[model samples]
Target: MKDKKIERPIFPKKAIITAGMPYGNKDLHFGHVGGVFVHADTFARFLRDRIGNENVIFVSGTDCYGSPISASYLKLVEEGKYEGSIEEYVREYHEKQKEVLEKYEMSMNLYAASALDRAGEIHKGVSEEIFNKLYDNGYLAKASSPQFYDPDFKVFLNGRQVVGKCPIEGCSSDKGYADECDLGHQYMPDELIDPKSILSGKTPELRKVTNWYFKLEEYNNTLAERVDYLRANSNLRKNLLNTIEESLKPPVIFVKRKQLEGITDLEEKLPKHRTIDEPKKPSITFVFESLEDRDIARGVFDEVGVRFRTGKTLVPFRLSGNVEWGIPVPDKEELKALTFWVWPESLWAPISFTKTYLETIGKNPDQWTEWWHSEDSKVYQFIGEDNVYFYGIAEMAMFMALEGIKAGDKIDWDKINLPHLIANSHLLFMNKKASSSGAVKPPMARELLEYYTPEQLRMHFLSLGLSKGSVSFMPQVFMEEKDKQGPDTVLKDGNLLTNVFNRLVRSCFYTAQKHFNGTIPVGEISDSIMEESKEAILTYERHMYNHEFHSLIYVLDSYIRNMNKYWVNNMRVADTSDDNALRKQVLIDAFHAVRTVTTLIHPIAPKSCEKVREYLNVNENLWNWEYIFEPVYKFIVDQTMHKLKFLEPRVDFFEKHQSQISF
Candidate 1:
């Protein structure tokens, strides 16, 4: 006897999906769409089809209150670039971002902003509520710590306003801010090396400032357990888990051997730590058992002029800062006149966006709990690998703390239903990482539309294998050194749709028109074809559940091409042998394959698939996953009377842009 077949993957009854928010400072670059949004939108569209459309909430927003936006506004104003206020500046970029998202056909239920109109008001309320909850739960503390202050400008600097080299061990980030590096490692403000104030172009001083902080270090063991659980049971990305584990390591300091030689009896003066001295290495390391001991040793090293760099580890997650351009932090005791740090506030902006969307539909705002706080529901956050430290670690700890789980208490992952993070690796441009501030400028998301259709770009982006590694977006149109006439590598994956799948769809309709009076013939589908379709469906479902999108694309490619081959090989025999029954059987089997292929590709290339539906003369029910395995005739009210729409000569269901036609 054969072994029992594995059960299909289970999906949540209710789900919330989110893409990482783009800053309101500039228009979207290609990485924003290719690396994150397109993948997220594809999965969201699949969920809407797999489950009921009403059960999924997909949202994202403009991060409108960050220091980067404020800094850009100030610089523009100083350069006589614009005369509008800061709010107007942010609104202008927000509108542009929305327009770009629309151009890409991203199926977000709501693309809101943290500081615009109704969403802004709701976000303020949500921020205050989270702050009060953390405070009441003893997770928030007011600590007086040094912040970067520029004496030349007589003002306090926000994180983005200060530039320095990252002091985290083994970090290769090109840009580092006050308290965190571009790679998202947390450290103290004073740990940055060679700090310079962007406002004054001068070295800044560290002045004691009072701000509220989330006691993240207190949740070290809890976070470690969470990481272990995800590693063993969840589909979390490997690189993301490695980054989180790096942050969970015990605190340590690395000092040059020469610098430490000046201090005699250094072990007696400092706190207890294990020293690792290697004769072959230039640096000696001091590992501590606790963050408290690490800080004590740091102070002792400072007094003796022993320069050192700190390793990646969890520190106090700051909740408030002194930036005047941010949301106002609630006045609690002496921690007055402070603003919520942009990072912490941005984490919960999706909840606010969900509430705003619900209220817009005339539903109670509090009804969002059905999607976020229930056991039958799950939240999937799509982010870049650079943000794993914040989303995977910081956000998880904060959500647990909100559920009344104390710092050291073990968290039941099922009870909390914390978010499932899907982090993609970097999307490099021209084989190098591109950033707006970097030397190699990246193309904007909208720029690619001039060369290809949105569906073409979407299909290509989804096939790039970003889930496993950093893949380069090397568009032939953008290459600086290219032949005027060479095969475009970017269109290789897209041709599976534009050329092969398009040809298969047209063959089915044209054959129906030629032999069967443009009506779908009723006959039995072969067992071999049915089994192949089931295999493809099961494989695709598994890849989607695991967030293996590139592999899913491969499955689609193989299934679709084999389907085309099936039509070509069988239809030839029927045409030569002059057998009506054979032709009818071929039409029945090929039509079923076409229907299945259309439904599977609906989420990736929706517009073209809808066109395929129109020519088939089918209703919108063709997309319902419930009828996925059934024949197209099942959707016809009267199979005998059903006739497909007339196909015009030289018609193409999936078309290439006119620019691609040389003739």
Candidate 2:
């Protein structure tokens, strides 16, 4: 088939940009880059290049709520700085989050929701509105529950403050839950003997408080419907469906000896050894005549590291012994003593950050509601799978509790249901750089930025992000691959990372200094050849449009690689240094190829590309194939006189990292 030249269109007008909200509990790391931000920026930049700059807008922020931040706050209170106002506490963390994000070049247009910002008030108002809607619809109610309160601390205790022995027999940890032990033994908090509050080191008093609960059960059907719809079309939807299905199954019920009919069977059963083969051997029948003898069963099961549940109420219980933290319920006296509960919210630094983000931009409080509560907008949440429940489900419920009075006046809860995108990327653990919950290791994106250009990073993620699969941010693998090809390749023979970057640098260097005359100059171009390169550029654009980002990279890489190959194969002394016409043709073709590559790569590494563009002395706005193939590209080609640096091949680059990196 004859190679046909194609024309490329100018660009688009308007574009939307968004990145995943960061969680306040952990510091940012490389996994975040390979997983979220880099890809977001890549896509955003592409849109900016295609459409006008003013037409594109990207907005995102941190997720500063839920149990984790709340837990962090309680820890602060224990540290004895809990006396300040709530606003003071919220401010401190907001600043910290800003510092972290700013370091990574992850500049977003908005900040995450906070409890103290105008965004917080908006959130609170929306939450209240949603609650009121549900209430009027009979889907919310207040219920009284008996909870442990530490009188010594002068505070009501949530379940977490009560600590006790593991109900599981020989497992022997003080950390057991009411339903399950650390060893997986099942028991109840009520059955905990001599339970004490870890906070004050004293026995807790049982007190009753009225707590509000949204009728989640009522929306279970609605949630299930959305779940089914998502399962049909989305990858994450199917995984959640399986979990919900498993949760809906029948539960095992265990009964204790005290509930038995006046017969002591403790002596009838002999203590048994631990063996899966003889699960019911040695007559545990005496200690557990019926399932009701949960103490004996729980003890024996605890010894064996097994768990069972109560079948009666369809509830699962564990024997956990946690201390300090969680929202406290108000007592009957307090209900009458105060108009409202003056209880505090989270005091963690991130909780304070919401106001920091809003105030940083100097936006009015009402403005935040425009994005968060608007029904016309669709929310797409990108996060790791580990954060799905908190950022996705809990936040949705919280949002529902905060919707407005009327549908248009407030955030629409129904519109924001389970239908939102929970783009949970998979894990990419590193040996030296694996920053799970400890040590502020460098983010994968930052390290990668040092080695690979944005285009390379973008391509790698889109390749692995093939519908929610995990992608590692390891740099050694790519570096090592370049090393195996030897020293002459893009990467040096010894240092893989440096070599790979050098190759990208060479690409820019070659484009900047095309001539050996010390200055780049314009050359006349053939319309036919210019038109041929334009077709290739058009093909690249189409690939991006389809969201086939990997393919797009493949197309661009091949074009540039072949263009380099063409330079090497044809640069045979130019037949006596001055055969003017032939030399000019060679330069014109090289210019066209390099110019095309520069335009294509501008979005991925805008800063680096800008440098190359400056060196080439060309206007970036006129970067489309149409103008790029014009006399300007030839003019820049003619003025360059510096020695050209050949782009080294990729094969030799991998050998450099063979020893330092392992998968």
Candidate 3:
């Protein structure tokens, strides 16, 4: 009868958490930290407390080798802005990224780069192993896709070297590249319209380029089936599901119905297809059985002079490219000079990081299989919505294909260990897409630390409901004062800690010092207080299990403010009447609430929470969930001898930034 409440959500025995890797071309921006890293770090920290700290492994790193990095390096070197090699350039930025992450107190097991340090050596082997597994399983294919080539520059253009318009129907991407848009839409290089070479300011031509590709189109049905499973069982973001579902559609092209009238025997002229007629719409969809058939139908459309646009669907995911600065690919037959395309390599970098961390601790690198593939352990990958196509579709399909696939095989997903993707919607800067070189440049991750404490920023970021939709990050310091009237939205969540939660804890300590000689009076917490703590704790556990961070903030706000009210309302009456019994009882209840709040808020505000623990004079065991519902006195081994640290007057556990303080 005492335990009656909502059932608590169960957590995995062991978990691996991965935040999306930031590119080495630049240090992290506000979007990268606020949108992805903070969420991932919060969940990882919560898992350590809910489960054991030893059971959780959180990792992320710098993506050092990619077309984007290469492009950025070339420009910097050519403009006399840099005086180092590409590796040196990447390493420099990687160091900056690591420093900033530490300042933000990101508790990662390892933040290894893809092409530096011991982790890099391990990553190379991991990359080759994954490639060989797919090849041996017959999941890899050799395909010749068109690559952009600039004649004036006399160089083969990587994806970042070409700029063009997207040929996909109804895409609002600001810029498209050789094989994909900035928005993560995939297409062949030939499909890009009016491609211009960034190297020479001249039009680029499409040339045949042979490389290894994953047969992603073949797994459309498999991915669609898995998406259905996720929809039923997982707490996936709707935007993520919608994006993946769009890519699972069969190969199709949209053409205006008026253009179809001129062709004689249209059914015979086109490759085998079914016309999906939409009577009210101007364009009709021609769904093809295979990607090959769709390409053939494209040639026929060109001959008939009918303009058409391709729809979003599963395309062959490229595994290797001709880029010089990349993870070296294992040579296949005649393809010797190819390096791994960054997207494919980065997808498995976390695996390398896991193995690297294991080996450092004197465990066998092969031990990673138990962490990654065992049912007892689960991997939670946190990514931004922009990567839904890669992580959700291409990366997931590739993972399944690694499990010894044949030309035709139905994968029993129950046996395979697939990571649960936690995709967040974009964190827009002032309601605009965040870009480093674009209009309305956003503050870097480090720059924000100058204005606000790390804890303040962390709380505000977790309060953003990015799981539902895109949210604007409008820091008033960056905007005109006229644009906003009330207090800044960024300060709302932090105030709960700096004001409400802080005052509650300080009152408990000062009362204990004055009345009980700095020792907690051993007594039972009131029935109402116990039930409230249980409700708050159980609700927090459920939300953490689902990765519902914003909801967790709301739960804490309500709990902390109410606890403050209870203390203020009762303690004032006790002090006025000189009722020592009532005052001691109220202290017991308020101290219980303080213990509960500190433990609950530890994941989001670790430094401040640890300060509370230090003043309480407790060991690390106070943060453990083993005795989550117990009173604070139960945690002290010898309560009679224990005394909390003496607190000075006006001591603040959660502090505000000096920039916000007036002299």
Model 1, which residues run further than 4 Å from truth?
1-4, 278-281, 481-486
For model 3, give the 10-residue run with minimal summed lDDT: 404-413
Which scores higher on lDDT, 1 or 2? 1
lDDT digits (tens) for residues 1-663 of candidate 3: 275656677778999999999999998899989999999998999889989998999999999998889989988899999989998998999999999999998999999999998999999999999999998877889988889898888889997789988989889997999889988999999888788998888998788999999998888888888878778877676677888998888889999999888677767888999999989999999999999999999988988889899999888999999899998889888889899999999999999999999999899999998888898899999998888899988888888777654334666656667888999988999888878867868899999998888999999999999998899998888888778879988898999998889889999999999998998888889999989998898888888888889999999999999889999999999999988899999999998999999999999999999999999988787889988998998778688799998999989999998898888
lDDT tens digits, residue span 1-663, model 2: 146555543333444445555555555555666566755666656766666454444555545554345555668777885765434555565565556555444445555544545555544444334434555665445655455777888876543456666533345444653223332333444545567886788878777655554443333334445456556654444554553433222222233433333535423442431212234432122222233343455465454443433321112211111222222222323332211111112211122233334456675544434434455433334445544433343344434434422212333234552324334345454433254443535553444445544444444555554333445444454445644433322122112123333354453345334544423335665565566566666777776554445566666656666665655555555645645566556666766665676677666545555655665565656454335445444434433443333433342211222333356
TM-scores for all candidates? 0.97, 0.57, 0.98
List runs of model 2 lying over 4 Å from the truth: 1-26, 32-34, 50-57, 62-90, 112-126, 144-209, 231-378, 390-422, 426-428, 431-468, 471-560, 572-603, 616-663
Give the candidates in order of TM-score, highest first.
3, 1, 2
Model 2, C-alpha of 459: deviation from truth (Å): 7.8
lDDT score at residue 633, model 2, on the 0-100 scale: 42
Rate residue 522 of model 1 by lDDT.
90
What is the Cα-based lDDT of residue 81 in candidate 3? 98
**Candidate closer to the true structure by lDDT (higher is better), 2 or 3:** 3
TM-score of 1: 0.97
lDDT against the true structure, each candidate: 0.89, 0.46, 0.89
lDDT (Cα) of model 3: 0.89
